[model samples]
Target: MHEQREFIPLDKEQTPMDTPKRTIWIQALKVAFPHTIPILAGFTFLGIAYGIFMHSLGFHAMYPFIISMVVFAGSMEFITANLLLGAFNPVYAFFLTIMVNARHLFYGISLLDTYKGIGKKKWYMIFGLCDESFAINQSIDVPKNVDKGLVMFFVTILNQIYWVVGATIGGVFGYLITFNTEGLEFVMTALFVVIFIEQWMKEDRHVSSLVGIAASVVCLLLFGKDTFIIPAMIAILGILTLARKPLEKGRVSVQ
Candidate 1:
């Protein structure tokens, strides 16, 4: 008879039959979760505010819940809430929504290389690419062993979940609440500023950052708050595209 071997128990984190896919996801989530903490705090409060605003507008809690799930466009959802209260105007709504979200076009282009080869996850990545998600994913430097795509996928999904959960809670309980949300909208702007600073600290050069600032200021001065977003995004995109080669070279040299 052959010698008997002793049985050994495997930990939850380990499995003999586990595929690389599962392992990568575990590693990715570990890396991704920390980066999304800021977004979680910001989205939670803002999403609640959005839910409360909708409830105050005579819409049921389901309205915010479903809209947050479907639209996932924070600013546009608020505008859509108002639109629903008025006479139907698909044409106007279409143009207005496009104008409001025009910056996403630039966002998509910027993420093309990052999101490529991500397989089916690319669809959800594109869908869930909100402001906070974009900011975090764009600025993050994933570890060599982790899967960048999975990290981004988790970041996108977690942010969406935070928004959806918050909106749902607010919708379900907003009537029982009575608090001031006057300045809550600024949370997103504050988050962006923080992310910008983080990115600035991580980078060797500030050319791109400075370009973004100058473009925004000039556009805001010329087009005003109501109309500057699209122009600013366009300016940023054009400038960055033209400077892509220099930026790549600088990055390589720094590395």
Candidate 2:
């Protein structure tokens, strides 16, 4: 044959922008409006309680207004005034708050590889990985041509709105509101119980719940309430790590 050169063609499909980006703001509003209503309500109540407690402890409304902006954990915000007043030790507060919210560590790990290339948007998303955002992201099936980063961004924005509104308005509600807060702290425990029940219903894994309860009980009994969280987390992690091989071998659909 007359000399012919082989030619390779470039694949034109490599660029992501060729596909349409989903209406991120619209999808965000869709998810935020309905899903965030209850969040706003609960955080309002939580923040009101926090404001009342802080006021009772001789602090201004602005104390919670600021802390809620900075340390936005749902449960941790409630106890922070006490922790700060009792110890005034940032080190203790830091460890104690993280111990209480250690589950976020797992959430962060799950999201670590997924949030890549988020550009300047990465900073706030990391800070805003609160309970609601984690829950929303956990359930989403990333839509076609839509970015997870944007979803996370919207989730964070939505959550911060709720928290800020809660914090800023809580004092007004607190002063105008009069209710006995005796034992109301149980709301935090109840919230966790509800979340656990929801997760359990979604996943339908008896072993996970059993292991969690068992580890929590064992740690609480051994280490006492304040210090037990660290050990409980360790126990939970150890058991889950051990189950990884079996879970993978069995091929459960969980990510």
Candidate 3:
């Protein structure tokens, strides 16, 4: 019997013109969207509440959509609502935004290597690095053959879409809906608590966790709730920096 060989197309120009370049994006979306389902539910409800809140304050529907797209930080966007109502203080608002998002610094540090070679997509990744995106992208292992950058990008886009859609609908129906949404704001708090617990469980040592709690408590006692976050962040960074050598030595010894 003659040996059989698989036929190969040797001509480069024979490649199909419509070969799907978009397949990567489609695959990424398929993989990423399911991971964000919980966030979809949460952001949608919160966005609607925010839109209703803005509507009640006489702002237009565009306000929520624009803010959701631009700021994209749920907690900070809510604070923006209050800032709009208060006296103009750009300096305070700037500091408050930095304080509220100080966690991103840690996220950036953790993702430095993960994002090193993603090229231009890195900018968008950084811009859209919300809590949900960071948690999902950091924790989950990207499946074989899936583009990690595209997956992360889609997660960011889908989340923003959910929020904007919810907020827009709520704004449009602001006067039509009269249901009290008390305690709805607690969703974000509960979400973060779950994230914190999950992160704590994944760690070998609880040093960082303990430091966070202790620092926050100390700051809250000293500065009160409204002003505690900034000081707590400062303290946490200081403590972690000071402890870095010991932590690194311990990690090395374990390995």
Candidate 4:
């Protein structure tokens, strides 16, 4: 018995992982309902714009409906109508999609620790990942054992539903009712502004948005609209990186 006595290294201690113990499906439904209102209304407008565009190209309303469900991406679904109109090369479309949404790869990294638990839910959670959902999720630090994956999944699904419904409405009603759909697309940008304002109200740092706007303005002038977005993103990232020391050293005021 004395000979058998031994000590395991602290690093080598084997802790049993906890299996997730919540009804994610139910949790998803409840958490999604409140946020779903703004999402659904906003998406309805955007989806209508996309559907109108598609239907005007001689396709039926059903086209946008089908694509919205499967693609489940707002920006991607909007541009995808062109794929059906012109040369529908599967290979190019596949590659184009990867190139267009390549930013998603980086988005996933931010979620690594947040979604690490929930053995089975992790997979579905990843699939539901999108820009709006990421924005909402990343804003909060979940407490221990919270099923964020479930929340994220529901947010994503709700956002998609909005898009699909909007698109279907636009595609079907587009021809019958001809009106100015112009400038309505700006509503998406407005949604971002609203979120930014909300976040700013809760926090003290408006510096990030300031830096982003300044850099974007300069980049827009130098690079032109088509090439500005990527450069603006790079500039914003660089500014944040360069400002880290000032932020940490108390040279900057967050409040």
Candidate 5:
């Protein structure tokens, strides 16, 4: 009986309440992507090498793909490929994995404050906290408006995606490829060196850096390459813990 008004659908009339959440993700991805490009290159190369290694061992493509996603521990996964071919000893495997990944304990401790209050993201962040992710996330400076948690989340996921994709490609097509991969394995090591140099240049104080170098050299000489990592990690943690107060004081004074 009254004048007909143009009808608009309720679903299309207004934006969803979660628009801010979507915006946060988009913004975080934008910030996170550039930082991870180097890792993308490194991870892809190493992951393909790993997949090819597994394929050479006569493992199925699914093995490397699944291991890359589930294990996500770069060095340990390589060791695991060898372990799978040998005698089955859960105790040996367990201890060896712990020894290989013992550095993560230090990584976790250093990140406690940075990762605090990140809510559920903390879970996946921890899960995907590889060496490269740790370096980037620990040093990155996020924009004030964007969420740091989301930035870290994207970095972790993006790095993993690179690794997974590379591994899948190598696994699926490794047999068809015949080019030499002789020196490709060193790509990740080169990446680590680059990251270390970048961090060294960024900081004014070299105390921590010097301590790490000295400890590593000492441990490597004493324990040799195959067994040095755990000892070096232990030495670094002990020295850093004891010197925390002095380090903080020095940092404050410098500022």
Candidate 6:
């Protein structure tokens, strides 16, 4: 006689709701904080400088805070500072902003696939996609156990905090502040390098990465530093378009 076996569910893992909301947020913050350390140092100093500069220009402390919160772009905010001193011209300012932030176009294109299905947080991600934040978020592969959205959100918020706080403090106490902060800018470069190496190590095939490096180098050599980015972006897009089928096939085969 054949024996009967007991039936059991294949997968009875804990769902997200099973965990406490506080625990979930705490975990996300824990994962996200280390990545923002460099930003903390860099943005704090830079924001302070920006705040002091605005104070020197006779603007109120609140000006730096409001601009830091609203504009959020370091270079653009600096440009806006100069623009504030100049004659009023909204039309010129509009085009100038576009020119200053044109590189974001490439960033948006590169992130299209990755940003899908992220829900409402996607808008904030796009809004806060500074060079450092994008580098960290796109390079990171969120672990299966953690919430990707929360981690990214915290990263964005923390970076902004460093900048805003610095700017606000500097603006309020510009007269009292007198200290050298020459090398703090290097933190941003170091952060990018770390992220690049992490991404390089994680990839099974460095085909696309190599292409990016090669194209960037070639364009930089040919076009000079100030105008090579657009060409490099175009080259990357073309190369990726041509390689899409093979890349997709390799991904499928691996899966």
The whole-model lDDT of each prediction reads 0.84, 0.69, 0.80, 0.69, 0.84, 0.82
| Residue pairs in clash, model 4 | none
Residue 16 of model 3: what lDDT?
40
| Colliding residue pairs in candidate 1 | none
Clashing pairs in 6: none
lDDT for each residue of candidate 5 in 62-96, tens digit (9 for 90 to 100): 99999999999998998999999999999999999
- Candidate 6, superposed: residue stretches over 4 Å from native: 1-15, 217-227, 242-255
What's the C-alpha lDDT at position 188 in model 4?
Answer: 61
What's the count of clashing pairs in each model shown?
0, 0, 0, 0, 0, 0
Off by over 4 Å in 1: 1-23, 178-186, 238-255
Give the winner by TM-score: 2 or 3: 3
Candidate 3 lDDT over 65-108, as tens digits, reads 79888898888988999999999999999998998888789889
Across 26-71, the per-residue lDDT of candidate 1 in tens digits comes to 8889999998887788788878888878888888999999999999
**Each model's TM-score, in the order given?**
0.83, 0.73, 0.80, 0.72, 0.85, 0.82
Clashes by residue pair, model 2: none
**Distance from true location, Cα of 143 in model 4, Å:** 9.1
Candidate 5: which stretches are off by over 4 Å? 1-19, 178-187, 253-255
Better of 4 and 6 by lDDT: 6
* TM-score preference between candidates 3 and 6, better one: 6
Report the C-alpha lDDT of model 4 over 154-205, residue by residue, as the tens digit. Answer: 7767776777888898889866656665676665677677777777787665
| Alpha carbon lDDT at 138, candidate 3 | 76
User: Model 2 reaches what TM-score against the true structure?
Assistant: 0.73
Worst 10 residues of 6 by lDDT: 6-15
